[model samples]
Target chain A: MRVELDEPKCVAAGQCVMASPEVFDQREEDGVAILLEERPGDELLDGVREAVAVCPAAALRLVEE
Target chain B: MVVGASAAGLAATETLRREGYGGALTLIGEEPHAPYDRPPLSKQILSGEWSTDRLPLRRSTDLDGLDLDLRLGVAATGLELADRTVVLADGTRVPYDGLIVATGVRPRRLPGDGAHVLRTVDDALALRDRLAPGRRLVVVGAGFLGAEAAAVARGLGCAVTLLEPAPVPLAHAVGEQVGRVLSQAHLDHGVELRTGVTVTAVTEGGVRLADGELVEGDAVLVAVGSLPNTEWLVDCGLAVGDGLICDEYGEAAWGSPRPKAGGVYAAGDVARWYNALFGVPMRIEHRTNAAEQGMAVARNLLRPEARKPFTPVPYFWSDQYDMRVQAYGYLRGHDEVAVVDGDLSGRRFVAAYRTGDRLTGVLAVGMPPKAIRPWRQAIAARAAWHETVPTATPAAGARLDGR
Candidate 1:
């Protein structure tokens, strides 16, 4: 599974960083999300999904093939 | 799913898309323009440093590339949870797999005509246009918004009079000692600060205080407060006191999450959720809480597995008269106060709150690091009063010089 982000909508509220720091990180300047990886293994899937759910700007998306 | 394209809605949408759900995504916003930073409206936008074009949460070009059907300039008039559809003001019905209410809050309007309230970009612009040299502006309320408005108006070369009913401006929120300091900031800047004055009635060019003193002005901008935009859900059957009732995860007390109707979520200024620290339901209208809770709702929506509670240390800031006033944690229960650094008389200081040995919260004027460091300690060690001593090594932004 891959995570796709809508950068425009993201406000970098730090919810994703708090939930799963490995998958989601926040830019220092304006607090917008900086997605580390597009896709992750099953171990990180749950976290990536949680990150998506908590993003206030609705900026995260999960890509599946 | 249909979610309002706001701080909370945008966060929820992104979370849904990131969780490997490729279902059809529909985002709608009432404003024709995209979402933008709001806190700056009272500062940068009013000061002419930032323009409306630069205010959107995301640039229009970026929102368009998301491939989701983005609707702007359309208001969501009604919601049929049972039908799993929302009726737009344009007479269009959009079906949603899930619904997230992120309508946010609007400014409270004044009583009579010609009185203005600030909420949206348009509102700020209208006020800015009227704020010219030699014009008189009477702000009714000495809260953060009122203080910022007065400061901005003064900066714009307008005469401003700030009237607050409270003897101390922010005593309810920041304690009496700190509030006196805050009020003095306005007095130092030539703001005609009047405390304990209630505006009984507003006339054409002024407001009449309870003492029969008529305070005159060219225009009246009422910064009383804000009411959440939750009228649409009147029939939705939820416990909405000040705002829509929700759990910590941002799920509505009664609603369906799926398109069919199970788990509905609310965020931003609209959701009054259960708070862990206070042990009672609380509502946070700050920009930080909105974004954080929006994410929490999104995570809980997609996967129930490994869902974490949204227990955030509250933080808020205000920029007034070239000062960056920041605060962290709750100041509600603080009984004892200490001045860790700076002095109120100088109009630059940091006030720390404590309940016994526990540090409850911190407030600072332009001292970001000193204000923020205690929050980390408070959250990490849950530091109480006596335990929270001034460290030898201050954080990056701490002002080291002392009295």
Candidate 2:
């Protein structure tokens, strides 16, 4: 599974970090989301999906490859 | 069964399916249109920058793949807890082993019609049609919703006049120090801001102020406030005041010194749940809260034995022109506000809110999310204001506004 982070759309609410801290982290200067693993394993899929849903800016997307 | 097919309701259903709950599920909503994100309604949606089709909470295929018994265009009029039945507006009484009330809130309106209150897409579209170049927009209630609409209208070349009963636009929400900073964004952008004014009604000419004066405008947007959609919940046994009262676990409860409703829960703007994090019963009306709380309820409802308390540090954001306003934790009822970082005059700063010693909230204007992200953890950790807040301590020469 591949996760995409649209940096410009990100408002840096840190919801992604809260939902799945291991999979997603934010840039310190601006708070834009950064994907730790662009392609997360099955075990991390749940958290990744939750992060995508809870994002206030609707900045994250997941693709099943 | 989920009673409101919006964010909270949709999130609850999604979590249930994601957790491998293959049982029968029903999603009910009053609006005929499928679930869509609301935050954009006042932003690009109202400005005609984004179409309605672009605002779905999730793609249609993903939503339909859930195999929900989709009941749209009908409202859940009555919820009979005793019979374990939910009576619908279309005369269907659906039973449920577990139920979630995510009916959410409706925008509080002024007296009379023609004026707009934006809670739904239709409301935004209706007001959007009236707003054009050189049009005059009289906005009542300088809250986030009102301010956002005003910004959008102004961007579209509408002459915007924002009215707020409070001296500062968001003084009641964010303290006066921060409110002044953000409210200035409107003024600098050519918005006529009238503070400390009570709006009586929507008149034929425009908005009628309490002082027998009419603010003439081509269009009026009443972004005053919202009330929980808890009328149908009346006489249904669960305590309903400003919102449906819930325990820390998001279960519907009776009253003060309350008893829990075992299988019935409430989430989103419609719920006033005990936030053990802040030791307060908070009913957050933000989009993020609705989604997060909905997931929390679904998790607890599935495994009541392994339930976790819904102690979320609430977050909210509003985009008005170039200024991006974001906040973490609760701001209402805060006793102290300290500008820990940046200057309000620059329109780029962060303000920390505290009640007693505990840090209750943080407000950041035009700062990067990363700058405010650490504060979220502080607020969530129940950090002390003096120690945890950046540059807000005595050693840092903090100027704490007791107001």
Candidate 3:
């Protein structure tokens, strides 16, 4: 799964990091979400899916391959 | 089936689709519009920075992609748990294999028809059109929604008078110490802040306070909390109180020790589910929790064998003027608060809440998102207050606004 973080929409609420630490992290300067691992392993899929779903800003998108 | 198509209800439907549920699905909502994000209604939408068209939760094509038997503008009247049927206002009884109730909440209004409450898009627009540079705005209840609306009105050039029954606004929710910062924010922004005052009646022109004082204004905005939308479930029989009582798995709770029927679940502002992380029952009205809980309930419904307790590190944020107030974990019932970073006088500050040794919650004001991220981790890990906060942390309190 390829994870993409829409930097503009990220409110820096840091929900993505909480849901999937391995796939996403927030920037220290402004709190925009950064894709820690653009393509995560299958083991981390569940958390990544949650991060995308729960991001209050609707900033995260998952591209399934 | 999912009822009340707001944040939680919409999220549940999306998750069910994403999780490969291809069976006949239904989405019901009382509002005529599709699901939309509400956090921005008091801020951007009210301020005219964003238009109404930008509010939909998803594009129409995306909603259509879900292949839902979408029912909009239809209100749920009652739930027949025994028959697994939901009676609607349109005289239709829709049956579902498994049910998810996300009716959310409605704003509690003052005992009059003259005032406006900001729960829906229409409510925001009506208030927005009335607010002018010289017009007076009398706001009842100094809660987050009230404060945010006051800020917006003040920015729009309206003279705002904020009223609260408590001595300090938000003292109960953010603690008396941290509440000062918010109270000060209103005063600093040229708002007429009145505390320890009550509104006994709403007038066509203004409001009558409990202490025989009449506060006149061009408009009155009532922001005094909300009541869960549980009137429809009066006979559903799945334990209802401040919200729909649910087990740790988000399933509606009934009977003693455990839920008798697991087919029904609740989420969002309407669900008072047990939080395993905090070991207590809580119904959070925040935006993020609503969406997260919806997805959790959906997963638990689809995969009951792997159903895990919905244990979330609750998060909520309110944008007031230039400062953004953010918090993580359960801030309620905290014993002590420490200013881990920033000072009380300044706009930027981070305060940590401790209930005994454990760090129960954390609040940040005007701080960057990165500054508050670690605190969420600390609260989620249930880290001890002393371990994370240095011994020199100052107590969260006020040195200004002598009241």
**RMSD to true structure for each model, in Å:** 6.3, 2.3, 2.8
Against the true structure, what is each candidate's TM-score?
0.81, 0.95, 0.93
Per residue, candidate 3 scores C-alpha lDDT tens digits across B60-141 of 8878989999999999999887778999999999999999999999999888678999999999999999998899999999
Report how closely model 3 matches the true complex, as a DockQ value.
Answer: 0.66
In the range B1-403, model 2's lDDT, one tens digit per residue, is: 9999898998899888887789999999999988888998999899998888777777788788999999999999998877788999989999999999999999999997789889999998999999999999999999899999999999999999999998787888888867887888889999999999999999886988889998999888988789999988888878898999988999998744433345989999999999999998999999899889989999899888899999988888888898878888988888988777777778787888989889889888877766787788898888987788656243235465645
Q: What is the TM-score of chain A alone in each candidate?
A: 0.88, 0.95, 0.92
Error of 3 at A49 (Å): 3.3
Candidates arranged by TM-score, highest first: 2, 3, 1
Lowest-lDDT window of 10 residues in candidate 2 chain B? Answer: B390-399
Task: Output DockQ, candidate 2.
Answer: 0.60
* Lowest lDDT block of 10, candidate 2 chain A: A5-14
What's the CA RMSD of model 2 in angstroms?
2.3
* Model 3 stretches astray by more than 4 angstroms: A1-8, A21-23, A35-48, A62-65, B255-261, B395-403
